[model samples]
Target: MPPVGRRERNKQEKLDRITAAAQELFAERGVDEVTTQEIADKADIGAGTLFLYAKSKGELLLLVQNSGYAEALVEGRSAAERIPDVLDAVLAIVRPVVECNRKQVDNGRTYLREIVFGDPAEPHHRDALALTVQTEEAIADVLRRDERFSADDAAALAHIVSAIMFLSMAATINRTNPINDVVQEIRDQVRALLRG
Candidate 1:
């Protein structure tokens, strides 16, 4: 691979700082309470410079939360691979993601909102959407382990499972529920879907 240029390195450094600052501030206080200026100040960059990286606070939240979600998905996928029961395996894949999202409930909810409604043309928003697709594909892989499901069936069921997981996490009633309770809720729904 070619060596990275100084300008590319500097830009990545700035992006890293911005992501770290936003992650800390959002975890400490929900996204609504943290301003773009606060994130810029914490990152030690100009507000204009921050905007150049992320056009709005919503986009910044997308940038920060997407990383957490991606990591959770990876953890969940690894866990799912070891479990024998299909439903249990799916829940194994779900539990880590629920834990990650519920770490800060409001931020979790806001991140879902951004994924669903943010401009898809934006780079961060596109990355978030791609993560969702990756999550669905992971779930589908687990479903395919069962002999009863064909490829298409597994894909369809995985999409439904993804919806169930996301809705459970984003529901207003679940905003304050314990992560275990939310996971159980998803388990029940997924179990019924698989059994039926």
Candidate 2:
């Protein structure tokens, strides 16, 4: 019933355009093979304009990551309050992400492969580390809420959750075992880690 605000609409439209362009280029040539110019061309924008949305290819990659499945991961963490189990908070992000991987299966595995070998540290190496810490803090918030997991244990559990997710995602990409089977194993390992 209400008309969309111009400024809000413009911002989202810009982002959508950029991401669409990037996705096309990324999917065609793979993450590392694609260039900003290519993405801009695909988006029909000047190369400099890409900078307005993201700093470098890596930031663009993270931004794209953030815009897509990354939201599912972040949303669960964002829901966590200080009163809940931090492990559960961590699990929230992990669970949805794993679910996404199971659904995408192919694209998910490709993205995981690209992220691992890709140039995440292209401009600011710190960005990668920051992403790491961001997820860690999200997990911490979940664990800290419970008051049961010690600080050290909480942090450790968070790392375990992170590691398992990566491994499981990677294993899914490997296709040696089904995603569901790997997921159950990861869940079991995570449960054991948290209990200890």
Candidate 3:
């Protein structure tokens, strides 16, 4: 890798501050309650400068949540690797994700909606697409390690599992159903998919 230049480093630092400030504010108050100006102020950047990083408050929330989701995926993958059963392993991978999103369920509802139906040109949509692909690859990797699932089948099955997970999570956005129940339901769905 080439050495980092001053301009690149400064840009990254600004992004880091923006991300940290957004996360803190969003957590303290819900996504809908936080404003772009608040985030910019917290980050010590001009409000106009914040727009250069994210087009809107929703995009800012998406950007902040993406990092948390990525970390959850890493933790989930590590936890899943230790499980002996493929079904349990997959649940391990998914549970952390649901937990992470549950913290900001309202924003999550909007985030998922934007991801599925938003403009292709939006940066958050692009980030979400990449995240989805990476998640499926992780699932496929786990399945490939198991004897029951073939490499060819693993990729397709990963897509199915992720779709089910996304739908299940979407359904829980406003409902009273316990998060564990949602996770268990997903586990059962995965088991049925594998058995078929």
Which candidate should be chosen as best, given lDDT against the real structure?
1
Per-residue alpha-carbon lDDT of candidate 1 for residues 98-154, written as tens digits (9 for 90 to 100): 898888999999999999999999999999999999999999999999999999999
lDDT of 3: 0.85
| Clash pairs, model 2 backbone | 85-142, 86-142, 86-143, 87-143
Q: What is the lDDT of residue 88 in candidate 3?
A: 86
TM-score each candidate.
Answer: 0.98, 0.63, 0.88
Better of 1 and 2 by TM-score: 1
lDDT scores for all predictions? 0.94, 0.67, 0.85
Candidate 2 lDDT, 1-196, residue by residue in tens: 7988999898778878888887666656656778899888878788887787777776666556544555665666666643254445556666666665555455556556645666655543344445556776677667766668778877877777777877787773446566567667776777787677
lDDT of 3 at 69: 83
Best-fitting candidate, scored by TM-score: 1
Q: After superposition, how far is residue 168 of candidate 1 from its true place, in Å?
A: 0.4
Error of 1 at 74 (Å): 0.9
